[model samples]
Target: EEALRGLKMAMKADSPAKDTAAIVIEPVLGEGGFYAAPASFLKEIRKICDENGILMIADEVQSGFGRTGKMFAVEHSGVEPDIMTMAKSMADGMPISAIVGTDTVMDSSGPNSLGGTYTGSPTACAAALAVFDVFKEEDILGKSQRLGDKLRKRFDQWQEQFPHVDNVRNLGPMAAIELVTDKTSKEPRADFAAAVTKKAKENGLILLSCGMYGNTIRFLMPVTIEDNILEEGLAIVEQALKEIG
Candidate 1:
C-alpha cells in the first residue's frame, strides 16, 4: 500500500497527469504471475482511493468466473470497487469484456460514451449467458478451492524435493512455482523455468511461464477438468520436472 501510495503521490505531482483517475489492479495477477494481492493492501488502497476521490478498479480478467474460488478475486478482500473489469474466462474465450461499476459512477458516463464494435455481439453474449448457467448448475467455485488444496500439497512436496523450486504461490487453483538457483539466495532461475516449460510442452503438457523475471511456471487448469484427468496432467508435469532438472 505504501508503495502504491508513493506512486499515486508521484503521479499527482505531475501537472499533466495530476488527476490520478483510478488505481487499476489485478486482484490475482494472471500473465504477470499469480501473486494474490494481500487483503490488507487492497483494503488500504480502497481507503486511499476513497480519500483522494479516485476510483478503485479491480481487473479480474484472468482471476474471474470462479477461477479463484470466487466469482471475482476482489470478493476475497470484501472491498467493493467503484469500477470492475472482467474478461478471459467470462465468455470462455469468446473475446468479450465487461466493465461494470456502481450506478452513480456508471450514470456519470454519457450514452454512447462506453461501447465498442463488438461490445454486445449476440455470439459473445450467448456464450457468457451459458457460462452463468453452468456456474449455477455446477459446483465450480468449490471445486476450484479443492483443486488448489490438492495442487498446493503436491507443490509443497515438490519444493522440498526440488532444490530449484521455491515460492510456490496459489489462490484457489491458480498457482505458480517460482524457479530459483538457491532457496537462501532466491535468485531467479529463468533458464530452469524455460527448460521445464519447453520439456513439459514437448511431453504434451501445455504449461506456461510468467512473472516479471519469467521464472515462474503457472497453472491454469480448467475448473471443469476431471479429477483423474487433472492428476494425469499433473503427473506429466512432475515427470517433466524430474527429467529436465
Candidate 2:
C-alpha cells in the first residue's frame, strides 16, 4: 500500500496524468536483489494503469524463460501487461532481445517504423528457435521448479546455521541471500558479501553480488544443470560462507 500510494503521488505530481507514458517494472527484481513483488501489488499496478491510460510494461529479461518456475514472472500475478521485453535466456546467450505488446499497441506503429541495423539476424533467430524447441521437448519448467525447491531447502539450512545469512529469498530458482552485520539490526554487510563471492570465485565457483548496498549474494545457475553438478557448486558456496562467516 505504501508503494502504491507513493506511485499514485508521483503520478499526480505530473499534470493531466497522461504525461506519464508507462510504468515499467520487473516482476522479480533481477540485479536489485532477487525479490519477487507481491501478486497483489502487481494487480494494483494493472488497475492503476488501466484507470490512468498508462501502459504497464514488464521487464522480464531475467525472470522469463523458466527462470522463475514459470514462463514469465508476471504469470504469478495473473496480470497481463501491455508490453513485455525479454532476453538473456531467450536465445541461450545469442545476443537477441524482443518486445511483445498488445495488438493495439503493436499496430500503432507502421512497417519500417522501427528498425535497427541488426534487427533480426538469421543466426540469432535460428538459435532462438532451437532454444524454444529445447524448452518444448525437455520439460524445462518442471526442472526449474525442482531446482528451486532444492535451492530453497539449502538456503533455509544456511539461514538457520549462519548468523549473518539473513533474508534468504527466491522466486523459483532465482534465489539470493543477504549478508548482514547482525540479524537483529539487519545492517548490510557489503564486505561480507564481497568476501564470500571472492572466496567462491577462488574455489572455482563464479558467484555474483547485488542489491542497493551490494550486500546480496544472488544465484543464477543454469536451470538444466545436473543434480550432482548443482550440489557441487552449492558446496563451494557453503564452504565460502563458512570461511567468511
Candidate 3:
C-alpha cells in the first residue's frame, strides 16, 4: 500500500515531473520491510509508463536470483519493465550491476562511449555463469520457495512465542517483523525494536533494522543458508527478544 504510494510520490516529484528519464523501483521493496508490491499496482505503473513514453525500470539487485521464491521478483507480476538493473547475490555477492534494456534505450551513445568497466572481467563473468549453472543443476529457484516456506513458518512461530510481535510479512526469503508497543499501538515499538536488534547482534546474529521509522528488524538470511543454520539464527533472534525483558 505505502510502497505504491511512495512510488506515486516519486513520480510526482518536481524534477521528475518536469523532466524524467525513467522510473526505477524494486518490485518487492527489499529493505523497506520486504514488502511485495501488489500485482494491480505494478500493472498500473506499467500502463502509466507506457502511456507517458516513460521508461519503467525494475531494480532487482536484492530480489534477484531466486531470492523471492522466483528467479526474479518482477516475474511474480509477469509484467516486464522497459529497463531493469540487477547485481547483488548474482555472483556470490561479486560486484556487478547489469542494465537490461531495449537497444533503443541503451545504444544511444556512440563508440567508446560505454567501454570502461574492468570490474566484471572474464573471471567474474565465468564465476557468474558458473553460478547460473549451479542454479540449473541444483534448482536453486525451487529451493528458494521451499526455504521461504520454512522461514515464514518459523517466523510465525516466533511471532506466536513473542506476543508483542504484531505479525510477519514477507515476500519469499525477504522478510520483516513489525513490533508493536503492546500489540495495540500497532504503531511500532521503537525502543524495544532497537533493544531486540542490538541484543541479537550482541548474541552473534547480524540484524538489519529497517522500516520508515527504523522500528523493524529485517532478516536478509542468505538464500543459500542451510535449514539448520536458519533455524539457529531464528533461535538467536528469539533469545534476543527474551533478553529485552
Q: Each prediction's TM-score against the native?
A: 0.94, 0.97, 0.89
What are the Cα lDDT values of the candidates?
A: 0.87, 0.92, 0.79
Q: Tens digit of lDDT per residue, candidate 2, span 9-88?
A: 87778544678789999999988898999999999999988998999999999999999999999999999999999988
lDDT agreement of model 1 with the native: 0.87
Tens digits of lDDT, candidate 3, 27-110? 888667778888888888888788777888999988888888888899899898988877777787765666677888778768
Candidate 1 has its poorest 10 consecutive residues by lDDT at 9-18
Task: Tell me how many clashing residue pairs each candidate has.
Answer: 0, 0, 0
Candidates by TM-score, descending order: 2, 1, 3
Error of 2 at 79 (Å): 0.5
lDDT per residue for candidate 1 within 10-90, as digits (tens), equals 766762243678889899988888999999989988987888788899998889999888899899999999999888899
Q: Give me the candidate number with maximum lDDT.
A: 2
What are the runs in model 1 whose C-alpha is more than 4 Å off? 8-18
